[model samples]
Target: MFDTMTMTKVVGGLCGTFLVFLLGGWAGDIIYAGGGGHGDHAQAYVIEVASADDAGEVVEEVDFSEIMATASAADGEGLWRNCRSCHSLEPGVNSTGPSLYGIVGRTVGSEDGFNYSGALVAVADVWDADHLNGFLENPKGYAPGTAMGYNGMRKIEDRANLIAYLDSLDD
Candidate 1:
């Protein structure tokens, strides 16, 4: 025979479990919907490239000097703040990433005495303005297995500014 107390306890436990699941789902929704951060800010949407043609591959492109002229150093400094956590501008002061002393116009993965990822070393060429822009825009895509864990900058303006800032650091 089921007693009244036993029935009440069983019902209460079931209700509690259901309530927990509901609350957890609600919290998860809130977190994801908040744009991965807790602030009101604009985000640059990514342009997906499904196919080689859809990827906007240009076989022959005309020179666009206006884009280069519009780069802003101040804006680049603003963007560099995000990188400061892993990199240092000071000479011989390496952090999570290598110290970025005179990084602009220098050979990629060629920082003396720094341990670089093989992926980065693979792209050991000059980091010209155009190359830096592309790399900053998408690190993983630029170098398949680079140790730099940053997702590329989505906004063109941000990449330009960041490149300008880096350029100014030349020795």
Candidate 2:
């Protein structure tokens, strides 16, 4: 059903297409391969990022003791909105995370009927103020391999307040 002319045209079309692709590739290499007179020399642009010390200075270090001293349970209750999705405030009711009811002074990994990662059990004995502060600052860092997916409360004030709110629940 096909003629020689048709075969020749088909071959020519494919060859043309391949030639166009090769030319395009060569053009791209010339443009992006630093062929614009910047051959093997140092980079023209330097990106300056703020040092860790500078970043640390930018964020005022919060004293958890001072914050907890005046921490309002009311403010903490509001901040609890972030934790509410993953945790429940009610005793014995575990959500995505274990219940935070009486968590302030409770032993870590001691929640009945809730499975806990061995990391938590190994690192912490009780959820004291200091331990809670550190854990709240960075859950994954405090207890590596912890199943808690929380990125952690960055602000010490917020953590203190949340702890206060949780502490208030049991009383």
Best by lDDT: 2
Q: After superposition, how far is residue 91 of candidate 2 from its true place, in Å?
A: 4.1
Q: 110, model 2: CA deviation in Å?
A: 2.2
Clashing pairs in 2: none
Cα-based lDDT at residue 117, candidate 1? 84
RMSD of each: 14.2, 4.0
Off by over 4 Å in 1: 1-65
TM-score of each: 0.60, 0.70
Model 2, residue 80: what's the lDDT?
91
List, residue by residue over 1-171, the lDDT tens digit for candidate 2.
689999999999999999999999988888899765667888789999988677754556766788889988899999999899988988999988899999988998999889888899887789888898898889899999998888999778888888888989996
RMSD in Å for candidate 2, one decimal?
4.0
lDDT of 2: 0.88
Candidate 2, which ten residues in sequence have the lowest lDDT sum? 55-64
